[model samples]
Target: MNVDELILVSIDDHVVEPADMFKNHLPANLADQAPHVETDASGVDRWIYQGRVTGVSGLNAVVTWPPEEWAKDPAGFAEMRPAVYDIHDRVRDMDRNGILASMCFPTFAGFSAGHLNHFKDPLTVIMIQAYNDWHIDEWAGTYPGRFIPLALLPTWDPQLMVAEIRRVAAKGCRAVTMPELPHLEGLPSYHDITYWGPVFAALSETGLVMCLHIGTGFGALKLAPDAPIDNLIILA
Candidate 1:
């Protein structure tokens, strides 16, 4: 069959979270603590949460750039494609590439958001829910069936994880990203069935799928700490 006849639906696409993601989603009291984008002296935009920088604005959103250009990080959101975060532009880009639909994973705080566990704050659960709301209410909801809603769970607690599963499922999210290796994120490993039993049951009850995205729990591949970022991207 000709390439033009192909109907592709990408199950592993990603979105570079917008600067004002938490603006409408979070409660007023928590608004001050919500993650926001900040530009460093170098001009690279990074997501800052609770006074700490989480992830860069354009970590892997350089798909359309030339190979030689991929080695360099996007100076800021202005340098990245609007499709990387804008729902309408994303659909247009999909059409240009002959993609029917896409299930996008998180990139703002990372795939599973396990980094939030480092904070040990009760507000982490609220943040996860707010992110899911933005993903379901704004991102995928804007385009209806053109985009698939995937959520990030509060993996630090099994009870919270189950609650988030049911909550996002109620918002029309079909899948939630799970840390591929939960133990690495300070959670009980998959081998500990007792700890994860409720989480599994919640997914089964909500009819939501669990997506184990690689590198969410760990790096794509182990390499020296001094390895170049471009090498990690290419090899992974």
Candidate 2:
């Protein structure tokens, strides 16, 4: 056999979160305040709600889109035929490409979290927990050994961070992604956050890697008023 026949593995693939997540998980009172937007024939619901916070009002509105919209659809838009968002399609692609295993990160859910700064801390934490559970139950459990899940910790609270780490680990996650920059004001960088030492140590002991993925770092930057797309490309 050729050595080149060895299987490959991708450590950082992403899956689009299903759109109904917020509709299903948000408290009934809050969910009522959000309006559902139309999705494709998938019957998936997208919702939006304005943020009450200042300085970020434009960025404060949250939008949810169906995961299928992120997938390849031959009958749909020509530009949307990549099929990366569907787990089954992704697995087939991986098999054809000689990939034996893959780890999936959240796409839409994490993107939503970026705009949810105005939400109360408890609600934010609840959202993270719900997303983590949904990923495990709906994604990883579906494929067993073929798909490894990555958890997202509540970076705003160190104690909860440690608890969530253990909880998700027990649910079969092998890695976790935390904000590369502090998510909360007054919190230090990852390297300097003393309260997070135990969390990091626990991850080390468990052989789980703490991933600092893009769009997850903390810092200020300057960008042209009309150059958001170019800025994103350059940053990516």
Candidate 3:
């Protein structure tokens, strides 16, 4: 088979979320607390939530950069191609690559939303649902079958996670991203039946897949912070 004839479906692509994701989704009361991007004096953009920076790296969206330019991540969204955040452009990019469909994980939201655990309760759940709405209702919904809907769960609370699983499944989400090692994130481990039982049950009942992505529960390999990222990719 020729390379040009081989169609592809990427299950692990990612989206550099748009800046106004929470703008129309969140309620007026939570607007002030919703996550937003702020650019520092150096013009480096970071996701800030409730007065704290989420500390997400830009490497997640560096694919659009030239090979030599990928050594370091783009400092801000301004440095990325519109396809990194725009669904319309993303579909076109997929077409160019012969990708029939793609499932995009969240970016600043953390692979499994562990970064959101620092925030308070209902607010965290709210933010997650809002993100899901943008991802499911707008992002994937806009292009129909061209994309797979992947939702983020508030894993800090198992009950909340179950509710979110059901909610997003109703919204047409086929899967939810979860931390590979919940215990490392200060949550109960998979062995803790009491903690994960209901959550697992909810996922099974709703028929939504639970996607445990690497590096979500902390880095998969214990490499130094300054180590070359290529090492992790090659080794992983």
Candidate 4:
């Protein structure tokens, strides 16, 4: 077998959160406050969350187009693979690629779902919890062993993050997506032993791995302002 063709485990794939997630999971009282989609003046659909907006970065939704298209400009929802947004279709694609297991990070929710912290308390907590519930019950459940389940902690508060870690661990989640370099964005850095004490405590007990995805690390791509996308991706 060609070893490259036999790639089986993809630990850093991502999923586009379904638009109706909040509608399906949030109670009527809080559903209206949940992040919803809207096409902007430019006609691109973006997630509007508590005054912060995020659009699909071409990098994350990269399978359906030529590299030039996906790696250069931002791709709207229409440009992504149906599999990138649908669990059933995703499994079919995974099977086709011989991917026995995959772990998906959040798209609109940001790498660790850390971007959601920009919103107020309680609501943000509810939103993150809802995302995890939907991820496990809906997404991963669709393929069971074919998809490894990972959760995102509220990185702003270590104690609360620890609690979430334990909670998700109890629910069978074995990994979490986190910021690669936390201090760069004002969150506690990985080197801060005291800050991550509770987090390590919970994970040490549950044996979960802390997964760090790019884009949540120290700074954005260090490319010249006028550099071509190809050059940046090449450097990356």
Candidate 5:
């Protein structure tokens, strides 16, 4: 194929977050400990039901698409249809589009780290662990070179944060994204915290790239009443 005929890849696209049933595939004991594994007000039990993460509080509930449909076409109706957190389908879609490779981000995982009021340190650590494992084992593992998994770290806990980074890197993840907002109490930005120095050094050493995507937890911006929303949009 000519250069123009070659497909281009879009790294940094999103896959849906796990639903309440995400733990269903886990061992009974371990799955029981998974958060948000309950029924919703409508009494649905499945994880991807109605595109919401039931049994959990916070913003980790948005659904992208179902796994079956996603397996059929990933980029086609991502905006119009629901999506599953399946990485295999994502790779298939890339292949169908003639894309060579792509990087994937967690849709609901990033939202959890972004919302300050909903996610506490312990919960953040747990969810991050579950999400990372799912990404590496379920997503990247199946696709190998075709997919690059972006690790989600708990910015709230420095020690666990660094350890998680190391663990994911050992599993072949080379990029991680933390919310631009401070997910923990008392710390300013991730750059301002002294404890994060070790984490940063480790990342630099391992050639891991730390990405900051804007989210809700970054703290509130004080906008003057006279300022136009356009300015805020532009800054964003």
Candidate 6:
């Protein structure tokens, strides 16, 4: 093949995340507490995780809507693209756009289960594993090479985190979404290699990459402490 004909790859792609992701993957005993799809009192469809509302509504599906509407306003499933959650539809869109592969990070699950930190432990850990299972088995396993499965683990305890990393590493996950600014999120600093030695070692042995997306630890960009998100987004 000619160099000009090389396939384009999107290393930082993301998933809108279907509402039933955790529900379908979690154990029956814990499934009810998992995230689920529900329409808010305002009639907006959203993913409710442990009773907390999450995600950017239809932001991930903007391409499926009229350029004028979704770019500014929140939208529901009906108003957005089915391809955002459906793997088959996503592949078609990638084909149309000439993308051969994508490494999709999580939406509501945070940059790499960072959102799970807001909840309590134990169950929080379970949910992270659930999301990883769903990502690997259903997402990547379903479509093969079209998408890369990015897993997230419980990062509160270094020991448990290492174990979880090894567990997923054995499952063929090539990359794991991580928090770049852990200290900002009330966790240890990235310089604390003493606690992170095991993490790096496992990743090195398994050949897994630490993929950190923006806003995983905290706000990625905030021009003003109290400024409106709009100002920061536009100005930044």
**Predicted structure with the largest lDDT when compared to the true one:** 3
**Which order, best to worst by TM-score?**
3, 4, 1, 6, 2, 5
RMSD of 1: 2.2
Report lDDT (CA) for all predictions. Answer: 0.80, 0.58, 0.82, 0.79, 0.57, 0.75
TM-score for each model: 0.91, 0.67, 0.93, 0.91, 0.66, 0.86
Model 5 weakest lDDT span, ten residues long: 69-78
Candidate 3 residue lDDT tens string, 1-236? 79898999999888888889888898898898889988888778889987878643566777756655555443687677889888888898899999999999887888888777667488888888899999998899998998889998888777888888888888889999988888778778899999899999999999998888776534445667776767556664
Q: Model 6: runs farther than 4 Å from truth?
A: 1-4, 56-58, 64-74, 216-221, 224-236
Error of 4 at 96 (Å): 1.4
Ranking by lDDT: 3, 1, 4, 6, 2, 5
lDDT of 6 by residue, 122-214 (tens): 888888888888889898888888887788978777877787788888888888888878876777777999877888888888888898776
Which one wins by TM-score: 3 or 4?
Answer: 3
Poorest lDDT segment (10 consecutive residues) of candidate 2: 54-63
> lDDT by residue for model 2 over 143-186, one digit each (tens)?
77787778777665678778888888887788887665664434
User: So what's the TM-score on candidate 5?
Assistant: 0.66
How does residue 95 of candidate 6 score in lDDT? 90
Q: Residue 153, candidate 5: how far off, in angstroms?
A: 1.3
**Model 5 residue pairs with clashes:** 36-55, 64-82, 64-83, 65-82, 65-83, 65-84, 181-218
Ten contiguous residues minimizing lDDT sum, candidate 6: 227-236
Off by over 4 Å in 2: 1-6, 21-79, 111-118, 183-186, 217-236
Error of model 6, residue 35, in angstroms: 1.5
- Deviating ranges (above 4 Å) for candidate 5: 1-4, 18-27, 37-84, 115-124, 183-186, 191-193, 216-236
Model 1 lDDT per residue over 47-113, tens place: 8778877656455687777766664344478888899988889999999999999999887677788
